[model samples]
Target: MPMRPPFFALSATLVLLLSIPAQACTLWAAAGPDAGGGTLLSKNRDWAPDHVQILKYERPFGGHVFFGLYAEGNNDPGIKNGINEKGLSIVSASASSIPKKMRAHQPGKRGVIRTILSRYASVDELAADADRVFSGARANFYLVSDRSKVLLAEVGLDGKFSYRVVDKGVQTHTNHYLDPKLAEFNVSIGQSSSTRQARINELLTQSPRPFTTEKFAAISRDRNDGPDNSLWRNGKQHTVASWIVHSPASGPQKLRVVLANPDQPEALHEYTLDEAFWKKN
Candidate 1:
């Protein structure tokens, strides 16, 4: 009896499919008068095992900055992303897997995650370090924004970093990287990616005109729609993994923060801006 190649070929195809990335993460951004807010929603069997903490940092380094919304503790603090003293916000999303052959240019020096936060105080500053910061690291997508600008950084494990300035009048991002210039990593292979993207698009279309904080919050809390259907069915849609809103100030010192347990709905935390908060001078 002779073996057939068909069976082996089918087995190989199945294995390849199974090895591909399979996870769903969604984010929505909206700007308002002196304020902007959004949501971080995700669902995966093995998401990062981390505790979300909100810390208020005081003077010397940067006065009254909130730190560590979602983070993993290791050398230099693995902040998945967070907001800083200047109301500058940063968020990173996982990209496709990097090939093992890629060499690590600077391993054990200082984790790329910590170096970015400690060194760069603004989005522009971080943009300047994008090349060096992303080298020799696994593929990942980052969103950095301040009151005036929003930028996206896409980095590959091979040490390639691509930058995109969001000038679409308004910009939004999800888990998968969104730079056409980067090597096509085929993010569409993931069923969740397409589904979530469609859902986000739908929400964006339905969003009200003259976007306001309340409307933006509504979009973030929207779970009855696509992408959120699974979470809604499981009765966990409202229990937000994390949420953030950035608004401009009316005077010299003006900023606001709204934090809440989406799952609870009623439970919410709020903060107002102060002159001494952003800077002492």
Candidate 2:
């Protein structure tokens, strides 16, 4: 008979396996020349309570860039966030607790994100599709823009997607839903919403100028008051936090992107992607 493995070794193996960290969500910020002089600011996180993986799908649509994000089963070239060849940008965020009355009124469909991108060439165009696209799914917030315009779109859990056009100003968003109509369901109370919001405001206040890709990257990597050296989460504070800024793509063809770990300020990663690089296959 084969000899049995030692008890201590087996115990150690189990402990090691248990010690591995889980795959936490990731946040990213992207800004650059918009095929024109307009600026863009976008912030998004990839989250999962299940084995779902959120991805960006890029393709040519109507001679422009089209992209979207959808659940694994609903993959039909949908886009959660993307910028087209014409420089229009779009993105979405989670918003919980939609009204049942609203939920009952939506039309079911696949690839809603892609549908919005393919049909709408501007923020206004995308806003028009909000209610129809948001029906059936949980609440979600959106940021859509082109070289000359910007809009904040909110889709309630009840399938009501509303638009708040922001023509000229800076905007910031996190995980919570922001709509006066759905304010009763806003669950940000007692959460880290205040803390994270404060931090984002602080960073933006520190850097007030014409938005640039470098400035946008710097905002994304800011982890000033994080409890741990790790930028992933503030365990003591009980919250997962991250930030990003967007600007109209203009000026130099090259732009910088940076990622920083709060625990190790000295170890920062930076990337410079130019128009040519962004256009690569």
Winning model by lDDT: 1
**On a 0 to 100 scale, what is the lDDT of residue 234 in model 1?**
24
Q: What do the candidate models score in CA lDDT, each in turn?
A: 0.46, 0.45
Model 1 quality (TM-score): 0.65
Off by over 4 Å in 2: 1-37, 44-57, 60-64, 67-79, 96-111, 135-137, 188-190, 227-281
Candidate 1 residue-wise lDDT, 1-281, digit = tens: 67424322444444465454333345555443213332212121113222233444423354334443443342223445556555566665545332222213334323344455556676677677666776644566666666555666777533556876542335555555566665444323344444555665776676655555455556555555443343221232223344444544233222223333223343444444354544533
Per-residue lDDT tens digits for candidate 2, residues 1-281, read 68545323445444444232222222222223221245555452333222232334366445554433344432212344555544456666544232223223445523345555666677766657556665644555666666556777656543555666656555655545556776644532223343444566666666655556555555655566464222334443212222232344454223222222234332322222336534655
Cα displacement (Å) at residue 108, model 1: 6.7
Instruction: Provide the lDDT at 19 for model 1.
Output: 54
